[model samples]
Target: NSILGFQGNRDLALNMINWLSSDEDLISIRPKDPADNRITLSRAQMQGLFYTSVILMPLAIVLAGVSVWWRRR
Candidate 1:
């Protein structure tokens, strides 16, 4: 019943609704640009992101906890 497109899909959606309503004034402005909709990663970047999230973040937290405990002692 609705339409779909990959690029600039948001504009198509608002236009579709206006068409269905048969009222041109249903929307005076186009919808805001969608968020950066694509997620692209190179192999190195992917590995780095994975390590940062899965390893470095937890390591940093542990280090911070140790530092706090050491300071208290």
Candidate 2:
């Protein structure tokens, strides 16, 4: 902001620094934009999570139930 000569930077930086220093004047809800919040998952990671939940999990449950049933018999 200093190099760009934008006024917004001065307010933002000062607020952040003051907040870090525990200044009472700057006290309020911190600024946040929902659009900036994000979760990034690669395609492979997404596929692996889906497969674990959809396929491997149910198969594990069926195997466990079968083991218990066989033990009872």
Candidate 3:
């Protein structure tokens, strides 16, 4: 299943099924270490992202919709 790109708790479901069926072999494969690709932003950068995504993008979409409606009408 790990070959299919699923990385977390793959054997957990299988183990649970085995336990339910009273199977003796219980698999306990360790998890792979996650890659360090975390982002670190300053307060100003976070605020900019918040405004752009939460406020400005929606406002732009609404404005475009209104413009199209006005032109069509």
Question: 1-73, model 2: which lDDT tens digit per residue?
Answer: 4453363565567778888998959744455446676779999999999999999999999999999999999
Candidate 2: list runs displaced more than 4 Å: 1-37
- Model 3, TM vs. native: 0.55
Write candidate 3's Cα lDDT for 1-73 as tens digits: 5554465455667777778888847756656778999999999999999999999999999999999999999
**Overall local distance difference test of candidate 2:** 0.79
Question: What Cα-based lDDT does every candidate model obtain?
Answer: 0.81, 0.79, 0.81
Summed backbone clashes in each candidate are 0, 0, 0
Once superposed on the true structure, which residue ranges of model 3 sit more than 4 Å away at CA? 1-32
Residue 55 shift from truth in candidate 1, angstroms: 0.5
Q: After superposition, how far is residue 37 of candidate 3 from its true place, in Å?
A: 0.8
**Best candidate according to TM-score:** 3
lDDT string for model 1 (25-70, tens) is 7655455656887999999999999999999999999999999999
Candidate 2: deviation at residue 42, Å? Answer: 0.5
Error of 2 at 52 (Å): 0.2
TM-score of each: 0.52, 0.49, 0.55
